[model samples]
Target: MSTEKIKDARRMVHWPGHMETDYIYTLGIAGEKFFTEMKNSGRIFAAKCKRCGFIYLPPRIYCERCFEKLTEWINVGTKGEVFTYTVAYVDVDSSKLKEPTIYAYIKFDGAHGGLIHKLGEVKHEDVQIGMPVEAVFKPLAERKANINDIKYFKPV
Candidate 1:
């Protein structure tokens, strides 16, 4: 094991461009199930803690409150309301966007936690707190068992 420390600023090697690495990431048990169900059936799910009866929208493997292993899945449906939202004028790279994007934190009908996704088919000025919305899933063949399966939430 080497314990050498680079104290000189000039001694530190700098890599050009970007550090690129290849890796595989999985969403784990709960997330995979949730997305799979939605991608295949167009139905969203929530995990219910039988001990405390607290439902999680993203479906956790364990309950946050009681630490119970959450295996009971409930159909939370696609209906929800915008808890809050923001209009972004720039992309992830901070470049000016062609059109502003509306992102909203949508809370499902009876779930404790919800998802943060882009809202479509509505103008940013029209998006309001407590505005009803629903998931708009992509065509079955085009889905990849991920959050993108639901293209975006659209105002109901």
Candidate 2:
């Protein structure tokens, strides 16, 4: 091979880009029920494993542990506490926002799985771990059968 050809062969290349695609997701059996209930009745249901009595929020059709099929559904309390939290000073695009947003892992009483949501009606500087909070759902007419149906969690 020619020296020039060898130099060209050894040349390195750099490419930076993002993958783009369009798609829609169906939230499956348990998800459909949960979202439908939220959108239509403003209620939350936890799926309880028939075999081991494990309850899952954003309920699952099957148990994570015993691999048992979960069939029974029970209502989960609207009130919960902040399991963990953080104040986001930047947006998803990594740009700084004018106002900080507080995000938290809110574990409702009696539910095994918890919801991750934004905290409102409190200062970003005031958010604390394990703070008592309650979900503030949006008015029924405005709900869309998604977690956003609850606008945010507020101090209880």
Candidate 3:
């Protein structure tokens, strides 16, 4: 190969864009009882707007619609349908994930909006709108206050 061509190849091999940053972080609040239940009871709870009858999954302390403090807690069903989804080639931190992952908004029955989670046990090509799925929880001991406690949704 010519020396000029060798340098061009080396430049492509050492592309700057290939190097990624690792300082990213996520911060959020988990209400006291809301998180405690997930870690200790393995329950999926949502805050309900007592006045407006709106429910917030992944639980919120207040209602967004009416801007009222949520006063009721509802146990959401495990079964839900895919509202929409996208096949992600990257992980949460924007690093390329090894396996292609399906991220979806699942609308649980009787809920107003869907919660986001991974769709598993289904091929990337098989994921479609309105597909039925059920939440698969992590082991009780493995439960955390985070949304990951549900692990992922699988075809039911």
User: Which 10-residue window of candidate 3 scores lowest in summed lDDT?
Assistant: 24-33
When 1 and 3 are scored with lDDT, the better candidate is 1
Superposed by TM-score, candidate 2 places the C-alpha of residue 85 at a distance from the truth, in angstroms, of: 0.2
List clash counts for every candidate, in order. Answer: 0, 0, 0
Pairs of colliding residues, candidate 3:
none
In the order shown, the candidates' Cα RMSDs to the true structure are 5.5, 5.4, 5.9
Provide the lowest-lDDT 10-residue window in model 1: 9-18
> How are the candidates ranked when ordered by TM-score, highest leading?
1, 2, 3
lDDT of 3 at 105: 94
Give the candidate number with the greatest TM-score: 1
lDDT at position 33, candidate 3: 73
Best by lDDT: 1
- With a 3 Å backbone cut-off (N, CA, C), the pairs that clash in candidate 1 are none
For model 1, the superposed segments whose C-alpha errors exceed 4 Å read 1-17
lDDT at position 15, candidate 2:
64
* lDDT tens per residue, model 2, 25-140: 99799999999998888888899988888789879999999999898989986888999999999998999999988999999788786899999999977888889999899999
